[model samples]
Target chain A: MPSATMLPITDVSACCTNVTRETISAENAELLARSLKALADPARLRLISIVAASEGAEACVCDLTEPLGLSQPTVSHHLKVLVDAGYLEREKRGTWAYYRLTPGSLDAVSSLLATV
Target chain B: MPSATMLPITDVSACCTNVTRETISAENAELLARSLKALADPARLRLISIVAASEGAEACVCDLTEPLGLSQPTVSHHLKVLVDAGYLEREKRGTWAYYRLTPGSLDAVSSLLATV
Candidate 1:
């Protein structure tokens, strides 16, 4: 079952196959494409990097705007997208939300692409 | 220098960094995003898998249409996108065009994502 974040790639990867090993089903292709679409943007990719490189592989939403050179709302929007796509996990502490790389999520997608 | 195919991700990776190691530059983010955009479509993903799973990791354009259940032009367009993004290499043999995975291209992108 998918978490509340609804990671479609995680659901699809349960089958343990990759594009290069066999022809993927349309359903799996759609799900994987959705995840790729989430990461296919410049801002989102940058956001992921910033969060990953930060201490503890996490960063406060408050700290994201300056490095991305984007406004707070825009950075929040990208953060939301990453959270929704299951690449990042979000937790609230006091006045701010912090984001961290969801362990192995990137590697799962990486394995898919490398085999292709 | 970029190839005629203009693999921007390859050009960017020449800098010898992955996103997790540091904040990626805006220009590098843009180029990587462009390559990911080419791969963010379901049809294109399926097209790549079919081609990769074919003999010698290559497939003739003639053999692609049926498995994809897409028209020739539609499949051709997706292939063109993959070729332009440097994910696939196109070759002409007599009357038919063949496509094969460009060596190390997917792995390059994979390395970036996994490290992030």
Candidate 2:
């Protein structure tokens, strides 16, 4: 069953069979690749981790710049890619933009790699 | 708990907390990123999936070229990256090389992305 935290995934299959269970279709492979590509960078992963681990599982653009030790623009760029990839959710709050983990997004991709 | 299928991961933390649970260190993020980078390609994911689904959870370079719709050299290159990343294992089989999922390698990574 799909977890309650799982959001609607447009490009990839939901609860799709993983690599261990059966051969994945090419289309599904492409979608999965796109999602994984967004997470392929160390900077992006750090950004995600920071936001995910932040209080309320969310963080503001202002707060992320310091711990990430990256330029504001660079952090924003990574966040944008993550949002576009559907792994994150972005919201505007006053002068800053807040990003949050998109519920089951990471879990969905993780499950795809399951070998058991 | 780490599954029996999970293999030993040298670079990253074992049963380490994910981003959802806490902020990840840069070093861990880099290691995770490297692992994810290896799986960020459609061809690679397809390759992994195909190998995992094959009988005995293994495949030869010869059998992979056709379904992947890529040249032998291309397939071989991707396989090498996966092996280096520790997701797949390569073994000599007389005339050809057989590749198989490295037991817990994929699951260890999948567990890393767990949000719950």
lDDT by residue for model 2 (B10-102), tens: 335474557556778887777778778888888999998889779888899999999989999999999988888878889998999999988
* Per-model DockQ: 0.71, 0.69
Each prediction's whole-model lDDT (CA): 0.81, 0.78
RMSD per prediction, one decimal? 2.9, 5.7
Write one digit per residue (lDDT tens) for candidate 2, span A28-54. Answer: 777777778888888888888888778
TM-score of each: 0.89, 0.88
* Per-residue lDDT of model 1, residues A32-92, tens digit only: 8878998899999999888888988889987888878899999888888878777889989
Interface RMSD of the candidates, in order = 1.6, 1.2
Winning model by DockQ: 1
Those runs of model 2 whose alpha carbons end farther than 4 Å from true positions after fitting are A1-11, B1-16
